[model samples]
Target chain A: MHSSTFNFERPIPAQPWRGVAVLVIVIILFAAAAWEVRCRAVGYGPTLNDTEDLWAQARRRVEPGSVVIVGDSRAWFDSDLDELERGLGSRPVQLAQPGSCAYPVLEDLANDENFHGTIICSIVPRMFFAPGGPLVENARKAVKRYHTQTLAQRASHRLAVPLEEHVAFLKERDLTTEALLKELPIPNRPGALVPPRPPPYFQSVDRERRARMTESCANPGRLQTRVKTGWSRLFTPPPPPRYIPKEAFEQRIAQAIEARFRDTTAAVEKLRRRGGKVVFVRFPVSGELKAFEDQSTPRTGIWDRLIRDSAAPGIYFEDFPELASFTCPEWSHLSAGDSVEFTRRLVPHLRTALGM
Target chain B: MLGFFKYGNFLLENFQWVLARGGITYKPPHLDVFLPIGISFYTFHSLSYTLDIYRGVMGPTRSLRDFALAVSFFPQLVAGPIVRAGDFLPQLEAPPKPQNDRFLWGLVLMTLGLFEKVVLADTMLAGSADSVFGYAGPLIALDSWLGVIAFAGQIFFDFAGYSTCAIGAALCLGFHLKDNFRFPYAAIGFSDFWRRRHISLSTFLRDYLYIPLGGNRSGAARAMINLIIVMFIGGLWHGAAWTFVVWGLLHGSYLVIERLLKAFVRPTTWTESLGVKLLIGLATYAAVCLAWVFFRASDFTVATRLLRGMFGGHAQADAILSTREILQIGIVTLGMFIVQWSLRETSLEAAVARLPRSVVTAAWAFMAGALILTQGNSNAFIYFQF
Candidate 1:
């Protein structure tokens, strides 16, 4: 038989507890205040981090016949919600995520039997046709969060909005401990396969998941240069992994891309069968990033194949002089001013594509 | 029902494998089951109560409300210190008088826990561990070792953080929960490791399974078998995967080997020296890390690949971890070792008591500040799955 009766009280360290508490609070407050001021001085502002919760919030707003935007950051950045609302007769639900594949969101909508509305999917070919990696993972994560978010998580996100809206240093993507640590100037081994750090925050996101390029990023400056420089590295495809044979890896990638094309065509067809409309749009890219992306994932490749396979109406930025004229300040996304104009000009083409 | 959720697919897959070996092909219908969060912990909480009552250690509580409260004490309900019903029921017997000191101390502990989780585990180690583990290419030995080491630190902080937070939260509610971890990385032997690490699970297994199976009383061989059986069950308790089972079996094997060594080797002044203990502790940590490869890996393929890389099988492989990641792992692991070594013989409360009030305040402030910087981006507690 077990011996002892259960009686255990945790020992609370005897100290001047009140003094310690007060002092700790004071120090934390001072440190936080100093950090906030420093962040603001360095061009950081009170902007909500585009979290999975925020993505889920936007996803939940999608009604049966709602005009939904599903794609990568181009769709997120360039499309003005206000302009789209005015043009499309309904405000499109912004489901597009930065650095994420559009396929998952497209697939999710296809699977949603109730959703028979129009989908304006932005085509960043590399991201759109990504087989598996962070690009696909990010979109899948947002979609998963929409499905699996708990009441506690929903509540936490709701509470965080006010604080995130007011606090400049609450930038989860950049100013977090992990992000700051990544900013440290440490050299890697020559052959190290480390991924490049993501570009720092250059845009502000609103409650509706609308992202607008900040003035610091939009104008020709340090932030703009830094953001532009980071893109070519990110856009260029990673080298084939050493573990797999080169031919085998290439063949696997080819197969995956083919599968994606077939799957996308089927998804678009499914939506169309249910009285839904789908249009693929290739958003404008600029500078070195555009060159790298064009070289890697050319229009003759995934984009043309997708439009042909899906038989969805396609809008290529380069095909139209008006849309192609506006330059992306940072080479990847549109500035706040240009985006509104871009969205305004693009609305008529969208109307024609969807036959609205 | 809980077991079905956790083990349904695992069992089916294994069964299919077994059938294939017998030259029969079978395709079982897949069961899509959602694993209830903290299913393992709460099951133990309820199981311990029934067993305790069955064993005449404690009487069955008449009040269903009190029993329900003990079973689902929110703080420890999901990821636990696995608070026993016998311990908790008695605490609930008397209403606790809330004290300012205890509540503030609890808040301090909670801050420390969050700091460990957010800043240390998620920020410093998880990326490196994840990058190395998730890489599709062969990795150099340095990357392999760093990856495992990163995982070791990450799991410790992640789990220990949750336990500390649970204990602190319970304390805030005027209840006491026992410590789950006690500088486990400083343990000098497998026996010592179990004694310090996951104390609740270890004790629960010892009391319910090991002793009942003729623990050390019968004979050396029988005791060894019992230890392995208990650890096998312990490993299975963690997850449905064979990797977890392997992890458990590795620990069980380590325990048996230690027992055999103990039978031959005698303790002396030289053996008990600080340097020797430290060396042994490092070896114990290394072996534990090897086992953790199995625990953390997705499958045997990943485990074997990592193990081979660690042993320099991939001589010409590319280095996957960046210099920053390597430094982060090195600094965090070293800091952890120092803290664990210093506090091996004491409790956190006792250690804090010895510090100057100013020093305590500064440490608290530093942890809180770092936590604020983290902005709560850390993943959920590792043990919540278990």
Candidate 2:
């Protein structure tokens, strides 16, 4: 059907325009290459230069049978690898970054042939109830990577897809890239360690109110005062609603987490056929972080349901309300000392949970 | 009408808030300035329809389907040639029978439009125009002029490319649409330019605004005032900002002046002299760029800074143009201008027909190849916001 018609127009006379088009194409190709090389030489690709390269190198040389902290930013900052090794006799690799949401981690584990032992994931309450929640980002990134690979392969072969398909693929790639890029990274460092710059004018009043509330929440007698202050704070709208309340937001997050857990567990069961243990741990959080979760008023039984429904056994969940009691000079993040204390308490629980 | 209501309600609410907060001055949000998706294009089409109907040149569409299809045809849904209902409804009623040759030609046209947009406009924008326009610090006088010229070329190609895509898409769906542009940069005067560029939109204004406001018939001053009113409103139709309004006023003022000048100093030659052509083009181009300052900038402060820099406020010229960017800008502008100029005497369909069959076949192949190779990273059509 494709080769039915041949244009027998004067034996296809040598067209000067074709030569011009060829010349133009060649020049464009050379120019593009030069521009790319120049951009790379000047380090333009990633915002944080050499960050990915560092990860790639770290991935290659990690010692076998070492503890692995596999999660997002909380895992990156909260888990003290040296302290864990000192206490548990194994140094852990912190295989996580700021914006590494749950699904990618699960996909990575599913694809890994050598992944064994425990995998700790941090499931923050706010993450579950955030607009443009994690599921969208996961689906977007997966589709983007798929489309990019497809286009790159087609280009290499000097082949083209149909215009409609090409447009569809490009649109998907764009939507995915946009969503992923806009996904704000959870700040990893402790506030005291980072020492955030003075609040902008828009944030000054809100910051003061939050600080006062935190200070009040620390005192038992001032709990009533803090509650009054929180209600009064709502009377005066602070820096846009920090979190908008929508059932869809929470549902999206829950679905995303459940999907990740189910997929990861199924993959792990396949590996278990060859005799490998798979233990899933929900990482510990600071007291203030736990307080945020308490405020969230999570739909009762969703977390328990997810854990119970998982295909794999050895699922350990940590709900450390005491972590919030520590004087970690941040709304959510734990101090280094608090992180060490939490890990010391968590390691034994994980060991028992994994039957190690 | 619903678009107007939505925009008006949004603006009024924002304006009221700004007024209520007496002590603190407030800038309107970005959403305030952006036109609803298809407002500018569709409103122009609506205005054209009413005018055509009133003029007894075309009847009102008999069925809502015909009128709706005429207005909301997906291909030209965002940007447009402002397809008149008179010309469009017949085609919608009895959609053209799709022939293989027509389909192939439509494909070729669509490919060409994509090439013009993605390869030419997108690359030039990413490489040079964006940076040059965005330059905050000092710029040489020559650099400013160059920037303006580049912008003129960019807007022309961008808009014309969009129109081509709309028309080509319509053709592919077995419908005929009117041409929006006709090598407008080659025009010698404001009137000539209007005649050639966005023909439907200009005609709409002529029929609805200018004529209603005592167009040309009233004495010179009143006529000028009428012209200014039309253009200013036209500009506001593009955006909800003072900049767009000012841009429109500037063009309207120029048209008035150009008309008066033509009346007093009539050229003896049928063709305008090369010097006159160059002078008019340069003058008009510069005027357009000055107006674009308002179009591009966030506020008057940024526009002022850009204008000052353009006029050699700092006199920095060391890194104005990179060699590669210059080549790209040169090739795209020269290639497009030459093709447009050559096709001035012929319809695009006729021009394609004139080519040898092999050349025609190869041109389609080449266009397809180009579209595939450089289909950029899916930037939204600029007019979509408007």
- The DockQ-derived docking category for candidate 1 is medium
* Candidate 1 clashes between residue pairs 3 or more apart in a chain or in different chains: none
Residue B199 local lDDT, model 1? 96
- What DockQ does each listed candidate score? 0.60, 0.03
- lDDT agreement with native, every candidate: 0.91, 0.55
Residue-wise C-alpha lDDT for candidate 2, range B1-386, written one tens digit per residue: 74553357557656867787886566554444444567777776777677777777666766877777777888887877777676676565554775554554555567777766765666565335666666544455655555655666777767777888887787767777777888776666677777777776787788778998899798988988998999897777666677777878878988998979977987866436666666776566567678777776666776776677677675333235544445556676677667765776666777765677557655655555555445335445555666
The lDDT, on a scale of 0 to 1, for candidate 1 is: 0.91
lDDT of 1 at A275: 96
Please give each candidate's TM-score.
0.97, 0.54
Model 2 / residue A71 / CA error / Å: 12
lDDT at position A294, candidate 2 = 52
For the second chain, the TM-scores of the candidates in order are 0.98, 0.86
Tell me the docking grade of candidate 2.
Answer: incorrect
DockQ of 1: 0.60
lDDT of 1 by residue, A1-356 (tens): 22338889999998898999898888888888999999999999998989999999999999999999999999999999999999999999999999999999999999999999999999998889899999999999999999999999999999999999999999988888888888888788887777887899989999999999999999999999998888878877888887788999999999999999999999999999999999999998998888888887778877887888899999999999999998998998899999999999999999999997
